[model samples]
Target: MIALIDYGMGNLRSVAKALEAAGAQEVKVTAHAKVIAKAQKLVLPGVGAMNEAIAELKKLKLAEVIKEHIFKKPFLGICLGLQLLFTESEEGGRTLGLGVFEGRVKRFSNKLKVPHMGWNNIRTQNSELRTQKCFALNNIPANAHFYFCHSYYVVPEDKSLIATTTEYGGEFVSSISKDNLFACQFHPEKSQSVGLRLLENFVRL
Candidate 1:
C-alpha cells in the first residue's frame, strides 16, 4: 500500500486521485503513524508554512516514522514535502526540517517574483546517461513542463543529489533523487499527462 501522509497541510484528495489514476492500487491518506509505518511506499505532499507542517508532524510523531521509512522504502515528496526533507528552511524564520538531506529552503529573490507559479520546464540531469536516469522520471521526456507554485526552493549542499533544474528568473533545483527517495518542488499531480507518467513510474517502482 502507498501512504499519502496527511498532516493537515497537504492537498491529499487530489494527490490521492492522481496516484490512483497513475495506477496505484492502494493509496491511503492517513495521519496515523501505525498506518504510515505499515505502508510499502510513502508520499508526502504538502503546501503552506513549513513551521506549522513540521509542528503537526511532530505533534503526531509521524516525523520519526517517516524518517525510518525513508531509509528502507520508496519515498516520494511533492513541493513542501520535498522542502521538509532538508536540514532547515528560511520560511517563517529558520524552521528545522527532517534533515534527510543537507540543504536549506530559501525564498526566491525579491528581484524575481515570489511564489513562482504556473508551468515550467525542467532539464533533467544526465538525461543522456542511462545509468544516471531517475526512476521517477522514467518515460518522461526532456524539458517536460510541470506545475509549480512556491515561494521557496531547496538548495542541497550535495549537488549530486539534484535530479532536475528549472529556470524562473534564474535556475533552481526542481527535483532531487538519492537511493530510494525522489522529491520534487513541482506538483506532478497537477502536471497533466507527463506528470501522470512520472507518478506511474513511481507507482511501478
Candidate 2:
C-alpha cells in the first residue's frame, strides 16, 4: 500500500489518482500514524503554507512518524511537501520545517514573477544522478518539462542531493534526493506524459 499523507491541504485527490494511474495497486490518503507507518511507500503532497502543514502533522502525530520512516522506505515529497523537508522556510516568516535536510527555503527574486506558475524544463545534474542512481528520472526523457507553481524553493547544504534543476529567475533546486527520500518542487500530477513516466519510475523503485 502507498500512503498519501493528508495534512489538511494539498492536491490530495489528484496525487492519489496519478499514483493509481502510474500502476500503484493501493493508495491510501490518511493521517493515521499506524496506517502511514505500515504502508509500503509514502508520498507527501501538499499545496499550502508550511507552518499550517507542520502544525497539522504535529497535531496528528504524523511528523515524528514521517521523520522515522522517511529514510526507511520509498518516500516522495511534492511542492510544499518538498519544502517542509528543509530546516526552515521564509514563506510567511521563519517557519520551522522537518529538518530532514540541512537547508533553507527562500522566495524567488522579484526580477521574475513571484509564483512561478507554469511548465518548466528540468535539467538533470549529470554527475549526481549518475552517481546516486536516481530512480525517479529513470526512463524519463532528458530536459522534460514539469508543472511548477510556487514562490519559494529549497537550497540544500549539499549540492549533490539536487537531482534536477529548473531556471525561473536563475536556476533553483527543482528536485532533490538522498537515499530513500526523493522530492520535487514541481507537480507531477499536472505534468502529463513526462510526469507520468517519472511517477511510474518511482513506483517501480
Q: Identify the leading candidate in terms of lDDT.
A: 1
Candidate 1 residues 99-123, lDDT tens each? Answer: 9889899999999877799999988
Residue 67 of model 1, lDDT score: 90
Model 1: how large is the Cα RMSD against the reference?
Answer: 2.3
In model 1, state the lDDT of residue 22: 96
| lDDT value for model 1 | 0.91
RMSD (Cα, Å) of candidate 2? 1.9
| Candidate 2 local distance difference test against the native | 0.88
Question: In model 1, what lDDT does residue 34 have?
Answer: 93
Alpha carbon deviation, residue 190, candidate 1 (Å): 0.3
lDDT of 2 by residue, 146-192 (tens): 99999899999888788888878677889998876789999998899
Lowest lDDT block of 10, candidate 2: 124-133
